[model samples]
Target: MRALPAALLLTAGGFTAAVAQQTAAPDTMVAKTISNYSAKYMDAECQLTKGHYKVSSGATYLSTAIERGSIPENRLRALASGRRVITEAIQQNGQDKNAAAWYYLGRIDLHLGDVAGADSAFKRAEALAPGCAQDIGKYRRVVYAPIANKAIDFTKANQNDSALVYYRRAAAWYPASPLAPYNLANIFATSKMDDSALVYYDATLKATMVDTAAATVKIRNQAGYNRAVLLTRKQRWPDAVAAFQQYLTWVPDDADAKKGLIQSLRAAGMADSASAMEKKLGVTAGNPMAPAAVTGATADYNAAVQAYNAKNFAAAAAAADKFLVVEPNNRDALYMRARSYVELKKGPEAAKAANALLAVDPMSETALSLLGAAYNLTRSSTQAVNTRLRLNALPFTISSVTAAPSGA
Candidate 1:
């Protein structure tokens, strides 16, 4: 999975399909993920010199059924004890040796450190059901600790061997889960199995085209991104470019991957190719939008720019206020409002904007520095620090919070 799991939001994209059957798909409410692997993918073409690629079509869900729910705690316990949830499932009139039951059992064991048991269970699942492994992964989704998350602390802490044991189990339970194969491919890459990594990377992409559990936009983009990074490492510039382009299919605006595509082209000595990428991205030489997306109270946050440029504190403050009223959540407005507060000698108000900015995005560099700078502005330094820290650490994003900016 990418560092950003925003694709989870896209999982809800299939809600329309699910809602077609029922009023609302509970799974849509949880992951908001949509699987379109069943959609077609044969019309892909790649050209290195032209620095271009094309796909004949995109994807959409083939089936109306959408799976919901997380790996049940009981299933995890069962796998740990070398038990099969399929037993209970069969007794309860569910399918015997159901891949779904086995996958959940394996997932629970995987996280609980019963790596060997998880593997055996997964193998059993695969043996019992061959073509359905990937479909089973939909049942093993874990919000807090998805099986694909190899970068998390617990997996790294135990060393990859232990994690690999469970990961392998997950893959066994869901061969269609592109995430497992992709992760395993990275494992091989790190182990210097470039060839093996490439194979698995291909497998990951192939699996992704059919894996319902990983059809979210985030996961889809991540699959392409990770594969492209590996292709770059292998010095397969053409393939690298192709994979990155596929990534753009999901996240057309990912600056990081776009930068990587340019860098890779440069490294491969494909100047024309690199230039075309630049043209595609408009990065070689293009002016940014004349007016930024500033939702200020006034129409001319730009007019206030003159005062701001002149360092006129009073005028800047007045304009900043107008902007704040109209568009408090605006990034530039928030920063300027905070700055204006400082100049107006309103330390608390400035600090409030700093805090507000932090809520919207804790990673904001300007916000972080200003919040630190505002530390000495008032006796409430301790409060400010704690608030800023909490704002930063909260699991959800501030922009996602519908409430107006605190500074407003």
Candidate 2:
């Protein structure tokens, strides 16, 4: 009869006989097996002379046999024995620097369902032998998908702590994928952990940059937007402005993003640019104010006056704009808003506000004076001269004000 395969011979009664013979002096048998396998397969002496198993291929075969249910109990025993042997070898001989040893250790840990252990072992193997990086990544990808799916399930169930643990592992396993870090950032954001959220959002963005998949574009855009919002909430106005601008480049017409950009710009003291954007977007200072009310109007007018007194010109103009939403023809509020813009040195905005006041009270000497000052600030000499003529044409009264203080 033809000779049987080595695997079949090992799985048959031969395996039992071998174990029975080794039982009397198990430690010596282990060392002998390591030396024999190392000399046959590796063409070198075993790194640990007292180890149980030095051949990675033998562990691989036993792991496969266990999976196939061929004397699974015996295969499990062999795997356990080999693991302890390798652990002892590493400890005794400082075989931690041995790449092959660590690689096989990772394989054993993976087969045994010790995922964290496998991950650590594989990382050490890759660090020791950079040539093993590709193989390490291939092995890691096997575990990454299942772990990432578990993280997703936990996230959906609102078990955030469990989700975080699995997601962190998944991210480490496959750092090239944006999904893990993106989900992590969302979870942190939901928990009101802005700082942590920002960190993960940055990670997601960095990964997506390298991925360049069409699906990841959406993730990239959202991460950028979320990072900007967090910066805004933290009052890091300059950084928020840059972040919002970057996001807007990806989603130029996003209304909410535009609003965020506007807020950030205003906070960063780019009031002129903010005002220009507001006009471009056809939005007033604050777009959806409360419905017109006498009490609301009174409160807004008072706020404008107080802000103007405090020299917070932007706030004063914003308050007046809100008041005008309620009383569009209110001369006092319009005049206050115009004066605030002038104080802010925003000539175009002052001109626009002065025109609104003029539209309500054409013959008001104060309005004409402000209009002239605004035109002069804008360097519109002809318009300033015409505005001065209009002011002079207005009948003089004791209450009539001379041209607005040469704010230009």
- Report each candidate's C-alpha RMSD, comma-separated, in the order given: 18.0, 23.8
Tens-digit lDDT string for candidate 1 (1-408): 111121221222321232133222122211221222212211112111111110000000101111211334543333333223232332343333444444444443343444333444455555666764544344344321333444322344647676565455456545655656666676677677788767766776776675455333334555566678778877888888778878877666555477678867776677777776665544542221112233433344654555666777667667767766655545565666677677666777878878876544443445666766666577667866875664343221112212232222
Tens-digit per-residue lDDT, 248-343, candidate 2 = 788775555776788888888898888777766455654312112334555676788778778898998998899788667555677889988888
| Estimated TM-score for each candidate | 0.37, 0.54
**Candidate 1 stretches greater than 4 Å from native:** 1-158, 185-200, 211-215, 263-271, 280-408
RMSD of 2: 23.8
Report the C-alpha displacement of residue 357, candidate 1, in angstroms: 13
Candidate number with greatest TM-score: 2
By lDDT, the best candidate is 2
